[model samples]
Target: MDNAGSNQDKGNGKYAGKFPKIAQQTRLLNILVIFAVIYTLYLAKSLLVPLFFSAFVALLLSPLVAFARKLFIPRTLSAGALIVLLVAPFTFLGIELAEPAERWMQSLPKIAAEISKEIEEISSNIDAYATPPAEPVEKERSFFSWFGDDEKSPELSPPQDNTNSVTDKIKQSGIDIGLTLFGNAPFLLAQVLACIVLIFFLLVFGPNLFNVFVRDFPIVTNKRRTLVLVDQIQRELSSYIVTISIINSCLGLATAGVFYYLGIDDALLWGALVALMNFVPYLGGVASCVVLLVVGLVQFGLTSSAFLPAGLFLVLNIIESQLITPAVLGRSMQLNPLIIIIWIAITGWLWGVVGVLLAVPILMCFKIILENLGVFDHWIRLLESK
Candidate 1:
């Protein structure tokens, strides 16, 4: 009986030792899977970007599509109509703004010269009061003097004038860009058409697909939970996107008004630019500010009022971010600023501008799923603003 007991104890100890090894292997497998997924996303971005864009747009327009259905409109017709209505204003705006954008492009050489001049003037003004550091005197018997002093010092070449070279390069770049864009126009247009078609089909058939998916779940509770999770995600995300769109539109209008009052000729363009960039949160605002500062410097020189445009924009942005957005989004949807920045950085690195725009929405979806699953409470806390 004692030998049997010892044998049993030995078996338990052997299994216990293997258990930790097995668990470690599982962890390593999970880590490898995560890395593989990230690599796949990076590699397949060209394909995935359009798909993601279609999905998000479909999600956004889902409510409008539902409304049109209630009016007895065919899903196909309604989807097409909604897409046109959505795209028409932007198409018009782009047509109107093209001339201004071209004008800016044409004036780049002048802008560059003026900016350089301003920088030089500032440096000269600072140099007037600033003491220059004294040059260090070389020792007569320095180490390695024997090796170097025998060799004639190579003659230093005079700096060549690069101004014309820079201008030429810029013109060449513009021409090359124009050529490339013209050449790729068909491909780009096809991609755009494909994405629209995808969105339309998704709108028309998404419900059926989702219902099928939910119905296929093995357990009743899983089916119910899946339905609830999807519904909440769609509802909340749609509402959030719609609200943000309205707010951004109003902010753009307000910015245009302010710029017009400040005597900017292209107030509408600047406003439109701001509104578009505002989609990316913290990084977007900073970029807008930098662009505004450069615009101010170019238009108004280094005067005190030169700072007004950017400064005023900054104030408006602060009010929008700190007061208006918080009040609108509320605590429930609030996310940690750090997580947002990190996620944006990661996505931006992976997929450029489109990824940056999609990062927050994707993160919100992740949070929503976690909430529904009722697991990873610690992760929920980490992601939450509070």
Candidate 2:
């Protein structure tokens, strides 16, 4: 027994000596894996962005689809119907806003010119009041002046027509943009079609698909765990999406009312724009403010009243973000503000605008998975807001 104990101790000691090295290797491997995953996401964004969006849409509509199925509706028919219903509002909104949006686009150059004029006026006013620096007197040089080296100087070219150059450049830019859009139109259409199709399939088959996934798990324990995890994720995501949608809708209405009260043209358009932008958290809020500010400046000029719309929106946003959102979402959905910002930045860097939009949902997903796995407790704590 003593000899057996001694051998056991020897075996442990040998492993203990190698343990640190193994741990270092594991950590290195984890970092490499993370980098590889990020690179893969970046490269596949054209494919994955639509997939992620479709997944979210599927999650949001799956409950409705399931309910419809319970009433004896065919799952495939229900899925297709829901997808059409989902897109209908956006189509209607576009049709409604098209004229106003086009009008605004047409007026942009005039607005820009007005803004430039105001800036120039302000600069001229400042210059008028300020003392000008004295001009340096030029020293006349002789033909033989060695220090000036007049003979070595190149002959002056005729002044170029900057206006024509500018116009040509603008035309060229327009043509290039037109060509680029024309080139990508088919691909964009394909992606949209792909997303719609994927959403339909997911809505129709998502539950059965997940069940099959769980069934394929090697261990019964794993299967059960996965089932629970998937169920929880679906429930939580659906709840979050629905609640947020209602809140954004309400916010949009309020914004429209505010804009109308302020006599802002295209109030409904601005409201819709704000509502869509609000999905992106901090960045969205900032964008809304800038849009309101520009609209205010364009409509009301550079006076103090020009800030009214933006300031009011700022106040409304603060109330909504701090009070209404937290109350509606509850503590369970609360994420660490710092983590949220970092996640948004990382995802934005990885996948541009789509990444920024998907960041919160993806982070929530990871948080839920980690929680269910019963690991990374500290990391979960870090993810959860105070």
Candidate 3:
């Protein structure tokens, strides 16, 4: 009995010693898996980014697709027609804006020179006020300068035309931009084509595909939960996208009107930019303001008018972000600002501007899913105040 008890005790001790090691190995494995997934995502971003974009867009247009279906339209036709309808306005807008955009591009050199000159004048004025007069000192000439074979220090002349250097730099920058756009044009076209195709198929066959996914799970409860979660996600995402889109369009129109009233050039273009940037959270407002500031300075120099456009945009954006969005989205869909900012930074780092735009929507979808699953409920609570 003593021997058997001692053996059992020894076995227990051995197992206890190995448990920590086993847990450590599992943790290491999990970390490795996470890093591997991240690396793969980075590698596949070019393919995946557009896919994700299409998925979100499909979600947004799902309601319209459904409406068409209710009118007895076939799913494929409805999807195709909807995609065309969605894309056509943007296409028309681009064509409409192209000439003006080109004109702006051509004027960039002149604008840059004017801006630089204004900056220099402002700096000089600042220096005149802020800097004290320097004391005059007697300078000793070098022996070479004093020699009869006089070595004169070359007198540096102020540039006769400051625009030349600025123009050259602008031209070089334009060339670089042109080359980049030209090089990427085919690839971007292909991605857009793929995305359109994906969006169409997703819209047409989404329910069928979802049904298949649900059927793959063996447990009935699991299937039910999956359907419930998906339904909730669809509802939340669709509502959010539709509401935001309408609000942004109205905001854009209001912005364009304001800019037109203020006599800002390319008011439509600025409005379009503001509308797109507003899709992003805090950073978007700042970016729009910076663009307006630059344009304002270039157009109006250092006068009070120079700051007006930016100030107006700041106020509008503040109202939209603070009042309009909250009122529309309500407390349930509202997210913690800190979490939104952090997610934006992370997505921005991973996928650049598009990632930043998609960050909140993606986070909201994830939050909805997790909340439904009863997993990370605390996280959801922590990340959303209401």
lDDT (10s digit) by residue, model 2, range 1-386: 99999999999998998989999999999999999998999999988899899999998898888899899999998998988898899889989998887777656656655665666666667865784554454455666675663455433444433232444454455456556655876988788889988998888888787777678755556676666777787888888878888888888889999889878889999889888878878888999999899888988887998898788889888999999999988888889877888989999998887788889889988887787778999988888847
RMSD of each: 6.4, 5.7, 4.5
Candidate 3 lDDT over 30-113, as tens digits, reads 999999987887778887789899999998888788788899999999888889998999999989888877777666656766
Writing each residue's lDDT as its tens digit, candidate 1 over 49-162 gives 889989989999988888989999989899989999988998899898989877876666667666656556666577656845444544456577777747554454454342
lDDT of 2: 0.82
Candidate 2 similarity to native, TM-score: 0.82
For every model in order, what is the number of clashing pairs? 0, 0, 0
TM-score of each: 0.83, 0.82, 0.84
Q: Between candidates 2 and 3, which one is better according to TM-score?
A: 3
Reference-based TM-score, model 3: 0.84
Output the lDDT of residue 348, model 2.
93
